[model samples]
Target: MKKIIVLLLFFITTVTKSQNELGSWNIINVNMKIDSKINVFTEAQLRSLSFYNQFHYYEFKAGVSYKINPNFSVTSGIGSYNTYSEGGDFELPMKNKEIRSWFQINMKNPLQFITFEHRYRAEQRFTSNGYRNRFRYRIGATMPLNGKKIVPKSFYLSVWDELFFTDKEPYFERNRLFVGGGYEFNKKIAFQMGYIYQFDYKINDESGRDFLNIALLYNFDLTKKEEKEFTPATTD
Candidate 1:
């Protein structure tokens, strides 16, 4: 894909920069609550069909990230989902497995009261309905309200907005917006939650689709450190 190639080139360029950009690796767990309504036109025109047997999904993902430094990181992930319906779905298909990858850059001092990060994600979805790919990018900022005041820098909070696109090759389009929060526990673990909203697909008397998600994250440094340890003296 064109987007994939662009990201790979950008990563190579960043690595060639003089400054060292690396810290550690992180592991995260993600859970998603998703609902979708699909319509299949009996006729090929696709305008003569009624929506039926909406699909619902509960997805769980395992993600791993490689930090290039304090400013950037790339993550890879995979997800498995559970389908909630089996009726009126003979013609339509649903989600099966997905591939997730993303690149993120942080633009702020680690000690600053606030920090911002840009994240780009691409997904390969193989569902019963069809195989589709999607791209999403997020603008996020972290506020260290308590991290600045607490010893050992143990706590922080963050908020983010995700903008997504689907079917960009044949016809470009926007998908949804995600608003979310992150809460840190100690230095190695964190919690996150969010709501997702789909736009411009409105129908009278129906609320738009939304998701309530929760995630657990574990992050730490992995850079090689110089050896410097003071040994205790032995008395003869």
Candidate 2:
């Protein structure tokens, strides 16, 4: 784990040194497990057009997820998304104000050395321009560097590609590709850093942008634990 982390840090540092400038995508995520099958989560994001400069977008959302089995799950969420004009920190004359709701399904498959994930989402957007519907699909893979499973104190590498679609004339809206590494601090906390490239199909302001993505994730267990063990009576 230590070696993997060192390598990942070196790679990121090299890329950052090579680039002139890159945008920043920061996220904080909190998840609570209500039981074995139910979970709730909240997330907030802040994004800048330059390295911590020209802050342009922010969002906050909350959601609930249900696990149908080991491989499949469903989630629903609602959020307020706001985008600012790109001159300074949250510049006036907001470019877009949106209230969005989405429903998504996730599927997971574990292989000998890697795990693959598939996500499909449908979104309803109430934006300043008008109301619209959008769809998205993402495929991702993760591999543990030191062990077969990504348990606590583990390091893993992940890559994903996501495509976005809308019901408009052009149909395709955006595409995003991400490559990153993560370190699990314990069963409940983790940190991830990565690079992402986003391309907009003539639809958004943030087209052809490269971002340094940083995220902190936390999980909490809310289930009750039994303190006593069951014992059987012996007849003498």
CA-RMSD of model 1 = 18.9
With a 3 Å backbone cut-off (N, CA, C), the pairs that clash in candidate 2 are none
| lDDT by residue (tens digit), candidate 1, 1-236 | 53344345334432333433221111233222121111111100000011223333334455444545545655556555444333333223432323333333323334446666666777776654466676667666655444343223333444556665667453334444434444455444455444334443322112234333334544332333321211110000
Off by over 4 Å in 1: 1-55, 83-111, 149-155, 168-183, 192-214, 219-236
Model 1 TM-score, all chains together: 0.49
| Model 1: residue 90 alpha-carbon error in angstroms | 16
Backbone clash count, each prediction separately: 9, 0
RMSD to true structure for each model, in Å? 18.9, 8.5
lDDT of 2 by residue, 1-236 (tens): 56757476637742764544688889988887787889888999999988889999999998899989977999999999999887899998888899999999989897988889899999999999789899999998988777887777777787889999988878998998888878777777888778877888878635367888888888777776431211110000
Best by TM-score: 2
In model 2, the worst 10-residue window by lDDT is 227-236
Structural similarity to truth (TM-score) of each candidate: 0.49, 0.89
